[model samples]
Target: MTEPPQTAEPSPPSGAAPAPGPAPGVTADGGPSPQAPAAVRRRAVLAGTAVSVLLILAIVFGSRLLRDFDSALLPYAVATVFLAFGVAYRYTVWISAPGARRLFRQGWRSFFSAANFRRAPTALPRMIATYLGFQKFLGARSHARWAAHQLLFWGCLLAAAITFPLTWGWFTFTSATGSGPGYEMRIWGFEIIGFDALGFLGWLMFHGLDIAAVLVIAGAAYFLWRRMKDRGAITGQRFAYDLVPLIALVVISVTGLLLTFSSIFLHGGGYQFLAVLHMVSVVFTLIYIPFGKFFHIVQRPAAVGMQLFKYTSRRTGEGEGEVLVCRRCHEPIDTAPYVANLRGTMRDLDLGFDEWAEYCPRCKRVLRGAAYLDHVKKGFK
Candidate 1:
C-alpha cells in the first residue's frame, strides 16, 4: 500500500517529461532543441543563392540604364574611380607585404643598375624577341595561351586608348587648344591609326575572348560539377572567392555575347545600350582586377621580373653567394652561372632580362631550374 501511494506521488505535469534534461542533441537551458550545424550551412546556401539571383537581375537592368541616362559625366567618373581603385589596391598590397615590397625594391634596383645598362644592353632586345617573335613562333601550348591572353589584353588597352580620347576629347581638344587640332588630322593620325587599330584588334580580341570564355567556363563548371559528383572533392570550407570569379566570368561572357549579337533582338535601337553596357563591364572588370584572382595579371609579371633580376644578379656575381634552394625539389644549387648566361643572352637579344622574369625562353617558368624543368618535362611529353 505504501509503494502504490509513492508511485502516484511524482508524475511530470501532464505532457511534460522533466523538460527533457537538455536531451542528447540539445544545448543547456530549457529552450527549443538546437539545430544541426548542417542546417545553418543549408540556410547560408539558400541566402547566397537568393543574393546571386538579385545581383544578376541588377546587372541586367542597370546596364540597360547606362544607355538612356543623360549623364555624360557618369561614364568618365566611373572609369576614373575604377582606375584609381585598382592603382590604390595594387599600391597597398605592394607596400603591405614585406616580400612584395622587397621584390619591388629589387626590381627597381635592377632596372637602374649600371651593370644592367652597361653589360646588359641586349636585355631589352632579348625580351622583345622572346615575347613577340620566339614565343609567337614556337606556339608552345603554354605560350599560345599566353599569346591569346596578351592579344585580349592589348585589345582592351587599345579600346581604352580610343574610348577615353574620343569620349572626353582629351587628346583632340583641351583648355590649351580652344577648338583643338584639325578633325582630319585627328582622324587620320589618331582615329585611323589608334581607333581603327583598336577596332580591328577589338574584333580579333572578341574571338579570343570567346575562346577564353569557353575554356574558363568549361573548366569552372567541370570543377563545380566534380565537387558535387565526387564526395572526396567536397570540403566544409568552400571559399566564396573561388566561385564568385567563375560566376562573374560566365556572366561577363554571356553578357558580352548578348551585346554583340542579341541586342537587336532584345531592344530596338539598343546599339547605344550595348555600347554603354560594354563600357560599364570593362570598368567593372578593371575595378575588380586588383582585388580578385585577376590580380595575377599584375602580380605574375612582377614576380617574373623579380625572379629574372634575382637570377641575373646571382649569375653576374652581383649577389652575396647565397645558394638557392629549389622550392619544389629541395635541391641546393648555385644560380650564379645560369643567371649570368641568361643575362648575357638577354643582352644579346637586346631585351631587358630584369624586366621580364615571368617568362623563361628556355624553361618558360618565371624562375629557372627545377620547376621550369618540371614544366618542360610535363609540357613536351
Candidate 2:
C-alpha cells in the first residue's frame, strides 16, 4: 500500500540537514495506531447502524413514491439506487487504501484535542474559502481554467441543493385546477410555493435554478472550448474525459431551460416531453456523480483530513516521525515515509537518477534546469 516509488538515485549528501517530518509520535510503534476503546467503537457502530437503517427506508419509500407518480420515472429511481450504492462502495474502497485509515484516525484525534480547540473558530471559514468558496488550490498558474471551474462549481452546487430534496420526495408540487401540467412547488406537502408568488423568496425558489442552468451552460461552453481550442491545457486528457461531464452539464441545463420555456409560452402544452427529457438528463447526471469527476463531491471530508494531518501535524512540535524537507528550498515537504515510498517506486522503475523526491517541487524544477544547462555546456565543449 505504499505510494509508488519517486526515485532510484542515491540519497541526499550526508551534510544536508534533516528537517521536521510528519506528526511526531504519529507512528511511534512503527505500526498503525491502536484500535479505539470498546465503548467508543460500540457507540460508533450503533450510530452507523441506525443511520444505515434510516437510509434504506428512505430509499425504498422514495423510489415507491416516484414510481407512483409516473412509471416512466422508474429509470430515475433505479439510477438513484445505483448512485447511493456506488457512493458507499467508493467510500469503503477509500477507507481501505494505504495510509487512509491512519490519516482518518489522526484527523479525528486532532479534531477533539483540547489544545487545538482555539484554532477551531477560524478553521471552518478558512476551509470553506480555500476548498469551496474560491477553490484557489486548483490551479497555481491557470486563471482562465479556474474561472471556468468556479462558474461550474457554483452552478452545480445550486442545482444539487434544490434538486436532491425534491428528487428524494422531501419536496413536491401540486398543480392548480386546469393548470394542465405545471404545478406549484411545495415543501413537505404543506407550503404552497412557486414562481407565481410576487416576492423575493418566491422569485429565488422559481428562478434560482434557471440562473444556475445559465451558469452551467456558460461553464460548459468554456470547458468545451478549452478542450477543443486550447490543446496544451488539456494534454493527456482523453476525449471522453473532456466531453462526458461537459456534455452532461450542457444537456441537463439546456433541457431545464427548455422545460421552463414550454411551461411559460406553451402553457405546459409540450411540458410532458420537456419534463421527460429533463428527468432523463438529470438522472443520468446523478448516476454519473460518484463515478466521474463529479466524484470530487464525495471527497470534501478528505480535504478536511488534508488540513488536519498534513498542515497541522508538525505543530505539536514533539517530533514523532521523520519529516522530509526540501534540501534546497529548506521547506517542509512531507513525511519520510511518504517520500520513501515515492523514492522506492521511482527506483524500481529506474527513473530515480537524480533522487527527485529529495527536493520540493520548486527545487526539483531548478535542479532539472541546472542539469539541462550542464548538458548544453558539455555539448558546446
Candidate 3:
C-alpha cells in the first residue's frame, strides 16, 4: 500500500549538496543489504556476542554447572540462546537510526533516572498497567481485536513464565519418592514445593502448557480468521510478517495439545511423533521471533519507559516550556520539548522537514492534500 504523504520544506535552493541518507531502506525490494555498512555490522556483532555470552553464563550459573539441566530440553535451551543473540543483534541495528536512537536513549534515561522516579512514582507502573498489561489503547480500535490481543498476550506471557526457567534449568522437577503420585519442584537447586501427581495441583501444574495452548489457539484462531475474512487485513497482509506468526502459534498449540491428548486418551499412540513435531514448531518459532511480528513482544516494554517519560514530564511541568500550536489549524500540537526533540531528530536525519513537525496531524493532511491537488492532479490536466 502507498504510504501516507510526508510534508517537506518547499524545494531546496538551487545547486545545494544532497543531504546524507539517514533512513534505512525498509522497503528495499531485496531486503537488507548483504554488505551492510561496517558500523552497523560491528554493532550487531558486538551486541549479539555480548548477549550470547551473558545467556551462556546465566545458564551455567543457574543450572548449577549443568547438573540440573535436562538433556532432553537441550534443543529448547539452544534455541533460546540463539533467540537472545538474534534479538540483541536486531535491536542494536534498529536503534542505530537517529530517531530510534533518540527514543532509546531518552526512554532509558527516564526509566532509570532517580529524579524522574521520585517525581512520578506511579507513572511508570501506571503506563505499564494500561499500555502493556491491559493494552487499553487497542480497545479504542476494536473490542474483538482488544480481546484477542489480551488472550494472546497473557497466554504468551504465561507460557514464557513457565517455559523459560524450565528450559534454562532454573527450574527442575523430580519424583518426591522416586515414583509416581508425589512430585518435588526445585528452583535453582533449592527445594521450593511438592505436590501430588494425581491431585488438583498436579493436574494444573502438568497441564499448564495445555491451558496456555488453548488460550493461544483461541487467540491465534481469531486473528487467523480475521486475516482470512477481513478485507482490510487481506489487502495489506504479507505471508511472512502477518500470517506465519499466527500459523506457527496454531501449529505449536495444536501439536502441544495433541501431546496431552495422546497421553490421556490415545494411550501414547502418537506421543513420540507429536513431541518431535511440537519441538520443531517451537524451535522454528523461537528462531523466527527476531525477524517477525513477535519482535514487537520484545519491543513493547521499552515503550513503557517512553510513555512514563512523557507522562511524568507533563505531570511535573518538568522540561517542557509552552505547548506548540499547529500553524494551519491553530490548535495545540504537543509540548515544546517534545516538538523540539522531534525537530532535532529530523534534523539529525536530514529529513529537510523539521518544520513539518510543528503542524498538527489534521493540518499536515490538509497541506498534503493541497500539494497533491496543485501538483499531481494539475499535471494530469
Candidate 4:
C-alpha cells in the first residue's frame, strides 16, 4: 500500500574522477587526521632544514670575520662541517621514523606556545637537573649505572662546551700573538672571565680537561666491567653497542691526557705527534657520535620536548588530536597513524599483536604479568 520515496543520486560530471572513500579514521573534513598532506610535511621539513643550515653558515661567516681562518684551523673547520652534515643526516633519519611526523607536529606547536614559554624558566632548571645533570630516574634504579652515565655525560658535555666554541673561533687567545703552533687559540677570551692572557687560564683549561679525562676513564672502566662481569644486566649486548664506543672513548680520553701530560712534563717535545693523535681521535669520535650510543644525547632533548608537551597538555586541558589511549594504563599513547603503522608491521611479521599495539609501556607490563599467571595456572591444571 505504500511506495517508498526513493532518493535521487547525483552523477559525476563527464570526465571527472569518482570521489575516493575516506581513508581509515580520516574524517570527510580531514579533521583529526594523524598526518598532514605529504607536500605540506615535506615543505615543513625542508624549511626547518634550510633555516638550520643558514644559521650555521651565518655563524661560520661571523667567525671568519672575527678571526683569520688560518691553515692551522683548516682541518678543524672541515671536521666541523662534516660533523654538521652527520647531525643533519641523523636528524633526517629520526624524522623519517614511524610516528615521528605526528610527534614533531605536536612538538612544534607546544614549543611556540605562550604557556610553554611562561613555564620555561621553572621547567628548564628541572630539565637540566634531572636530565642533563644526573639522569636521576635511571639513578633511582641503579647507582652504578647512573654513576657511569654521569661521568660520561659531564665529561663529554664540559669538553664540548669548551671545545665547540673554540673550534668555531668564538674564543681566541690574546697570548696567541704569533702564528706558530706553540701559540694556539684558546676557549674563553684570554682577557675576559678574570684570567691573565698567559698564566692561570691556560693552567685551568689543562687541569679542567684532565678532570674530564679522569671522569671519562672511570666511566669507561665501569662499562667495561659491566660488559665483562655483569653479563646479566646486558642481555643482548653487541660489541658495536657496548665495547666499541667504550673503547673509542677510552682511547680518546687517554690520548688527550697524554697530550696534556707531555706538554706539562716534557716542555712540549714531540708535541706534533701528540697533537696529531689527539686530532685523529677527536675526529673519529665526532664522526661516530651521531651514529652510535652517543645518540642518547640527541634523544634526550626529544624526550624533554615530549615531557614538556605532556605537561602543558595536562595543565592547559588541551589534547593532541585523535589521541589513542592505552587499554590498561588509561594514558594517552601515540596517534592513529603510528598505531596503524605498528599494526601493519605486526601483521606483516605474523606477531598477532595488532590489538595490543596501542598499549603503553606500563599496561604492557601488567598485561604480560597477567598472561604469565594464566599460563602457569593452566599448566598446573
Candidate 5:
C-alpha cells in the first residue's frame, strides 16, 4: 500500500500505507468486511446531491440567470437534473462494491500519479483514442457490430451536444434581420456567428438535430434487426434492458424527423403533436440513462484509465524483467502490480479463491472441470 496522494479527491480514508486505499472494504486485521448498505446509501446521497446542485448552478449561471432560459423546455431541463442525480447515485453505489471500489481507486490513483506520465507521455492519449474514442475492442467481436456502435456513439454524442445546451437555455437562435433569411446563433448570451438561413452552412446548422436523429435511427435499427434475427443475441436478450434503449432511440429519432417533415412538407400541420412526442421520448431516455444499459457510456471512459494504469505499471517494471505468468500455462497474464490488484480485489469481494487470479483463463476452466468431476462423480459413488 503506497501513500495516497495529498489531493485525493473523494478520498475513502486511505491511510499512509505504501499502497492504494484499503481493499474494497478491508478491515484493519486484513480480511474483507463488506461495506454496510447504509454507508453506501449515504455516500450515494452525498454524490447525487453534489452533482445535482452543481448542474443546477451551471444551468442558472450559463443561462444568465434565466434571461435566455426557455419556459417551454422546463420539463426537459428538469429531466436532465434528475438524470445527473440518478447517474451519480448509481455510480457511487456501484463503486462501493469491493472489486469496483479497488479498481476505481487504482484507476484514478494511477491517473493522478506524475510518475505514470514521466515513463510514457503519450500513453494516456493513445489509449483514449483507441479504447474510448475508436472503441477498437468492439472490432474484435465483429466489424458490423463495431460500425453500428460507432454510429450510435457519435449520434448520441451529437444529439447531446445540441440538446442539453438548448434545453438549459445556454444556446439560442435569433433572426439577424427580424425573421429574415439571415440568422444569428448565440451561446450563453454571446453571439457565435451569423449565417444565411438559405445557405449550406445554415442548412447544416439548423438541421444538425435531424442529421443526428438519422444516424441514431440507422444504428439502432441495425441492432434491433440483429437482436431479432441472430440466434446468439436472442439467447441473451432482455426486452427492457437491451431492446428498449434501441427502441426508444428509434422512437425519439423518428418523431424528431417527423417534426421536421411536418414543418417542411406539411406546412406545420401536426407540428405540435410531433414536438410533444419528441420531448416525451427524449425525457424518458434522459431519466432512463442512469438505471439502464446507457450507464455503460459513463462507465466506459473510466475503464480507459484502468488500461493506462496497467500499461504504466508494466512499463515501470520493464527494466526488472518481472512479469506475472499463469500458474499452469506459464504464459503472461498481466503485470505483477495489476495481478496483485486483482487478487486484492478478489479478497475484498470475499471471494475465497484469490489464487485463481494467478492462473490463465484456460487453466482456470480446466481446473474447474476437473474439480467438478472429482467432487460430484466421487460423491455419487
Candidate 6:
C-alpha cells in the first residue's frame, strides 16, 4: 500500500512561546513582550485631555455666536448650509466612493430583488427588524444602545423636518388661500394625529431625548476621564473631531431641558437671557450637526444600503468566483488581511485530506459551507 503523504507539523499552540521560559518580563500567555512606555501613555492621555478642554470651549463659545444674530433668517440659512455640506461630504466619502457605490447598488438590488422578497414574504417583519436592528445593521453597537441612539436621532430629525416646512411654508399641496399650504397641512396633520394629546407624547419624547443626551454626554465624559485617569484610551492627537460633538450635545441637552422645565426659574432679567441661550443651543446644534459625528446620520444609512447591495450583487454572480472561506473556522473570510492569513495558516496545516474549509481562529469551529459561501457573497470584493 502507498504510504500516506507526510503531513506538516501543527503550529505551536497560540499562547506558547518558542523559548523554554517566558522572555524577561513577558507574560506567560505569550502576549506582547514589552509594555508601552509609561511616558508615551501619559502623553497620550494629556493630549486627549487638552483636546477635550478645547472642544468644551468651542461649543460654549460657538453657541454664543447664535445669540448675536439679530435676524432669525440668517441662522436658518446657516443651519441649512451646514446640513447641506454635511450631507454632501458623507455622500462623497461613503456613498459615492467606487467600492461603496458598488455595495450600495447591491443593497438596492437585494431590497428590490424578487428572491429576497419571496424569502422574506412580508414587509412588516423586515421593517420591524430594520427599526429594531438599526445599530446591528450599521455594525455600530448593540440593539439596546442603538434603540437609545435612534430615539435621539429620529427625534432630532423629525423635529428639524417639521420645523422647516412649518416655519418656511415650503409645500405647495394645500389650497393657496393666503395661509401657506405648509402651515395649513401642519395644523391639519397635528390635529388629525391627535397631537392634542401630545402632552403625554411630548413628555415621553422629551424624556427620551434627555436620556439620549445623558448617554452621549456620559460617553464623552468617560472618554475625557479616561484621558485623565487611564491614559491608555487616547492617541494624544488633538483633532476638532475628538470632543466637539460631545460638548455640543451636552449643551444642547441641558439647555433644551432647562427651556422646557426651568424657564420659570430664571430671575428677573435672566428669563430673556435664558430664553436666548436656549434658542442659541438649538441653533448651534443644528449648525454643528453637519460638522460633527452627527454627520453619521446620513452616512450610516448609505453605508447600510451599500452593504446590502454588495451582498445582493455577489449573490447574483455579478462578480468573481466562490468567496474565500476561513479554513480554521470554516466561515467565509472577507478581504481582510488577517482573515487571509488565517486561511493560509489552515491550508498549511495538514488536516487529514478533508476538503479545505474556512474557520474562525477565535472560535476554532468549522463554519458551515453554505453559510460561509453566503458570507463571502455578501462581503467579498
Error of 5 at 70 (Å): 1.0
Can you tell me which runs of candidate 6 are displaced by over 4 Å? Answer: 1-74, 121-134, 137-190, 194-232, 236-239, 267-269, 310-331, 334-381
Candidate 4: segments with Cα more than 4 A from true spot: 1-59, 116-121, 176-191, 197-202, 318-381
In candidate 1, position 66 carries an lDDT of: 34
lDDT (10s digit) by residue, model 2, range 275-380: 8888888888877776556766776767776576544545544476567788898798886644665565566557746476788889888877788778856533
Regions more than 4 Å wrong, model 1: 1-73, 124-240, 246-257, 260-268, 271-280, 318-381
lDDT of 1 by residue, 84-184 (tens): 54545344434334445555666667777787768777774565456543445335645644544454445444545544434433333112243323222
- What C-alpha lDDT does candidate 3 achieve relative to the native structure? 0.84
Tens digits of per-residue lDDT for model 6 on 147-201? 5455545545555654454323231123234442222222322322222123565
lDDT score of residue 134 within candidate 6? 47
Give the Cα error of residue 40 in candidate 4, in Å. Answer: 13
lDDT of each: 0.49, 0.67, 0.84, 0.67, 0.86, 0.48
Report the number of clashing residue pairs per model: 22, 14, 0, 0, 5, 18
Error of 6 at 52 (Å): 33
Q: For each candidate, what TM-score against the reference?
A: 0.46, 0.65, 0.86, 0.67, 0.85, 0.49
Error of 4 at 160 (Å): 0.8
Q: Model 2: runs farther than 4 Å from truth? A: 1-53, 59-77, 172-196, 318-331, 335-381
Better of 3 and 4 by lDDT: 3
- Determine the C-alpha RMSD for candidate 4 after optimal superposition of all C-alphas: 13.4
lDDT per residue for candidate 5 within 1-381, as digits (tens), equals: 356667846566547655744233223221113454988888888999999999999999999999989999999999999999988988888788877788888888778889887878888889999988899999999999999999998998899999899989999888857975988889998999999989999999889999999898889999999999999997746677778899999999999999999999999999998889989998999998987778888788777878887888888898785579898999999899889988998887688999888999999998887888798776445
138-238 per-residue lDDT for model 4 (tens digits): 78879988989889888888778766666666666543445322345444233454343356665675477788888999988898989888868566555
Using TM-score as the measure, name the better of candidate 3 and candidate 4: 3
Task: Please report how far candidate 3 places residue 29 from its true position, in Å.
Answer: 11
